[model samples]
Target chain A: MSDAKTAIDVNALLQAIPYARFLGITVDQRGNEITTVLHFSQRLIGNPVLPALHGGAIGAFLETTAVAQLAFEFAGAGNGKVVLPKPIGLTIDYLRSGKPVDTYGRAEITKQGRRVATVRAEAWQEDRSRPIAAAHGHFLLQVAEDAAAS
Target chain B: MSDVDFSPEDLMTMKDVLIEHVPHAKAIGLKVEDVKLSEAWLSVAYSEQLIGNPETGVIHGGVITSLLDNACGIAVQLTLPGRMSIATLDLRIDYMKPATPKLDLMAHTHCYKVTKNIAFVRGTAYHTDEKDPIATCVGTFMLAANRAQPLPTTSKAATEAMKILAQKKGGDA
Candidate 1:
């Protein structure tokens, strides 16, 4: 019943999603914190001249972090899988160019209402203090059935 | 932005060159279907690799974000007189519905206005109908290098475009 007792597999939850796999995303959970990592790959380059990571790629990775965090929070530990949350909208502010390096993302639940949850996520390349981008997202959470299948 | 005496034909030829440099666009199979001064249309066909929720077979919302972002960026580039370093300063995407599996996603973007340091763009992603969009986005891009501050003429261009779009929808309906 408690989050501490529930063994959540955020990586497994990510692996089941094809786009997450395509993006080469993995999770690092330390206690209650889950930080999603986007592995550096050549295919992620948007500006070949500057060799910066694609903006869309960074946006997607950050969004994935938020969704995984939401699932980790709501999915009961020992549950086989977590039903994925759907994003209603996202506002991404690119503070700095995404360097072509391994990027890290983390999401914090800013607000949790009845049918919706708001999350704030940020991505950093080298220094956590200096984030390359940040996002505020709204998600539609299906709590009526929780993990009930269609 | 001042006028760039470019014909739609001139910009149309640069569509491939516009997307060839971005590896992510190629990785996701994004193509520039059409391009004009301050306007662009791009599309990405659905594939298993792009699916978000495998159970329902819907394309990931990220794909839509990428498509819309690129479309907005390309529209800004098409507006400029020459190629310049344009960075997406910010982008906001509003999802209207999940993308239908196996249906190609297309986005049309317009850079309606440009100021000294920024270019404003609005875009919509849809299967075949723009009115029934899967997602809509508005973004601002920071322009670098050769640029100028000019009167707002593109808004008129945008209004003309709206009339054309309205007529097309009416005909389709």
Candidate 2:
């Protein structure tokens, strides 16, 4: 509910995705920001000795965050239907070992072009100042049908 | 190719043990089909629970990321002569196109070179032919991230076997 205009159901959009359900990711929409949560599970562990969350899981969560941001932005632009933004490329840097706890992600659109968007995302566990991983990526967005026709 | 002469059974066990050590690989049902000297091939089948967009039923990009990462790690493991811990330093992936729904994804990775402290890897994910790729990636892993923890049981045995093979190549056998 950050925008003063039309409301978008973030949770419902995530729930429709099968992988999102498997990862147990949920959205926390607040005044001016939206946060995506990744609940920890033993299945997410990649290193049993270190007991660290899988790098892939963290990367995937960050991707979801960027896509969610795009979807919300599209809905706010007066577009009725949401089209899943397709990722063009992604680079993820693992800053720290992801502990066995809940992780949160947020994405900021760095630039949006006519056909592509660039986003930077971060994921953290306990402190926002210290992120466990960071990512920057590009995604292809579909213009609205009316805009396309025009 | 390695100096070590592995029986078919050793290779099979090596592949199985490699996947078993990574819990997420098991969770996502990853299989290590081939592990050459410094190359690896792995696969994961399509499943409904892995679709990123329910409307399109396309598998999420993260699945491909995980598959490529795992393949790279296995490629690095096969390059070493002894037990050494490695952690991913960074990974970059380029998505060529959305994967065809219900088609199993396969990944092949090669660790072409390893410096004293860094290992470099490149990988590709495809459905059938490696020529037709769904995604491609390049990554680096830090070698000897830690030595305090004990190496996995099967890896220990495999390294020991490799050491003996190395000694034989040195004309000591």
Candidate 3:
């Protein structure tokens, strides 16, 4: 449980979405900066022959990372309830492919507005110096009253 | 409409032709998995070479876009029946989560409708955990008659694939 200003339970949110749980995304720790890990595996198949991971998979990873950043911020708001933010647009730059191992992602809150929030997210394998992909997105925040009444 | 024939191997070769034609796709290792009247599936695996940050171990987003774009094209080919080439008008993807390390993704893409030149498609990517879709994509493709003659081998292969699919369905039924 969180205060009125803080967001809802992070673990609760993660469990709510089956896909998020499958990706191994958890709250980790809640604050301005947040970290989430996606345990990479070879089971994710694209072309059975090449068996290389698909690009769309990377994009989803980036998008989810970005959303999680927003959620972390929301939780930090101390509202005691996590809010679901919708992405209006996202632009990703794919720099490289992921290796056969777990990859980590981090996010920075560039700007937070009344209606929209801007976030920048990056993913890396073992090291932080270089990232496999980088993404920037605009998220529209939804308040509980607006969200629940719907 | 002239009847064109293609075998599975011929279809595989034509896939190479399509990839070679797209310069960006060629650089990224985009490949076609299956092609039919209104459905298709495409895949690419995780690779260290494809990461933007080698130190951090992450894959690029553009690669995913390329896969989705190719899937949309294949979906359009399914509607044309005859020889057809397709172009993407617009594509939007909803990334649900980040990909796992080393795991490849298969985009199970299919065309839902084709009206005139507009072809609509929807697809999702899954690894071992089908419940967690790595990405979801929706796109519109512009269908145009192909100038090149349909490879005889591709036509034949498509027929066979369809037959197999039908048999499997029949057995299940």
Q: For this target, which candidate reaches the highest TM-score against the unseen true structure? A: 2
RMSD of 1: 10.8
Better model by lDDT, 1 or 3?
Answer: 1
Over B10-123, each residue of candidate 2 has an lDDT whose tens digit, in order, gives 567558665766667878888998887888999999999889978778999989988998889888878876657778889999999889999999999999888899899999
Q: Give stretches of model 3 more than 4 Å off.
A: A1-12, A30-32, A45-52, A76-78, B1-173
> What ordering of candidates by lDDT runs from best to worst?
2, 1, 3
lDDT per residue as tens, model 3, B37-133:
4667677777665543233344444456667766666666655655554445546666676566677767777888877877778877666554688
Q: On a 0 to 1 DockQ scale, where is model 1?
A: 0.34
lDDT measured at residue A102 in model 3 versus the true structure, 0 to 100: 64
Full-model lDDT for every candidate: 0.83, 0.83, 0.59
Native interface contacts kept by each candidate, as a fraction: 0.68, 0.71, 0.08
lDDT of 1 by residue, B48-135 (tens): 9999998889999889888988889889888887667788999999999888989999999999998878999999999999999999
Which 10 successive residues of model 2 chain B have the least lDDT summed?
A: B164-173
Share of reference contacts kept by candidate 2 = 0.71
lDDT of 3 by residue, A4-56 (tens): 34544555555565445544455555544566676654333222111223344
TM-score of chain A of each: 0.91, 0.91, 0.81
Worst 10 residues of 3 chain B by lDDT: B145-154
Instruction: Give candidate 2's total backbone clashes.
Output: 0
Residue-wise lDDT of candidate 2 within A1-150, one digit each (tens)? 554555688878998988888887999988657899999776676766655778888889999999988887777664557777889999999888887789999999999998899999999999999999999999998866743563
Query: Which residue segments of model 1 deviate by more than 4 Å?
Result: A1-5, A77-81, A144-150, B7-9, B145-173
